[model samples]
Target: MSDTQNMLNDFRWIMDVVQNIDVGLVLLDKNFNIQMWNSFMQNHSATLAEEAIGQLLFNLFPEIDEQWFRRKTQSVYILKNSAFTTWEQRPYLFRFENYRPITGKAEFMYQNSTFIPIQGLNGEIGSICIIIYDVTEQAINNLELEKANNQLEIISKTDGLTGLLNRKSWENLLETEFQREAR
Candidate 1:
């Protein structure tokens, strides 16, 4: 092949690497149609790459939470920074497996997802990439920590009979929310 042809071939191969990566990788055009859906995502979702590629996401997965998608996509367009979502926030968006193929348990599941906006070289907006990573164990640990904190809060501020916040925690949380809303 000529040098120019070889360079084009190399570019194709590099693009293939990004798609074949072992994560839930998806690319969406600026209009939010699916541009690429990797093998890992296809396998987990029981969808064919051909069927998903170039399809509008809302049409393909009608079950998707529209409000959630709206907020994240809005962030991509308005803020231009990656947005992350932990498994606890919305586990139904993507399936997560926390176990190794050979030795791990099947029931364990968790994931973190990120949405990244893509900009073209000409300073024009182009596309976005959505990536997901398993984080089930970490989510569980965080939940445990939260439960402990809840118990501590109860003990630190409680009216023995009425089971209220002993006037202190109640004042704090109410004031905090009130101040935030005022801003």
Candidate 2:
């Protein structure tokens, strides 16, 4: 095969891999217009690539905290580096539903996104690529574990039958309070 044909085949293969990836892959221009939206985004958002492309990110996701997200993307653009946002900080960017049966406890998918600045041929920041990873399972597990730990701590400090502080716990609290008051 000729070199041009081989390069075309390689490009096609890479595009196929990107489109088939499980996570959301979005490429946006400096104006925030959607340049690329992968299959993962289409499946979760129920919007086709043709529909999303060329539209402004905020226009597609009006529910997004426009100010905060704009600032985040802007930072990536200005700093010419990557920026990350976690579910704990802002939750999902597009309000996609969590379809993972194991993490069905979540109504919406928790996301952790990375905004990467795409440099142009001239070494100038051209666009940004946002990679959205579904983190519902991790977030839910962490929350459940926190609750379990809290319950365990309460159980350790309280009398089960009376639901009140145990002797040792009460004594400790009293001593601490006594010290504070004396001071």
Top lDDT model? 2
**Over 4 Å off in model 2, which ranges?**
101-103, 178-183
lDDT of 1 by residue, 1-183 (tens): 899999999999997887778778888887669988888788777788899988988888776676778877888877788888877766546644444676444355566788898887976557888887766557777877898999887888998898877878889899999999999
> How high is the CA lDDT of each candidate model?
0.78, 0.91
lDDT of 1 at 102: 65
RMSD from true fold, candidate 2:
1.7
RMSD of each: 8.1, 1.7
Q: What are the per-residue Cα lDDT tens digits for candidate 2 across 18-127?
A: 99999999999988899999999999999999999999988898988878878888888888989998988888788987677762998898999999999999999999
Residue 87 lDDT (model 1): 78
Q: List the residue pairs that clash in candidate 2.
A: none
TM-score, candidate 2, is: 0.91
Model 1 is weakest, by summed lDDT over 10 consecutive residues, at 97-106
> How well does candidate 1 match the true structure in TM-score terms?
0.65
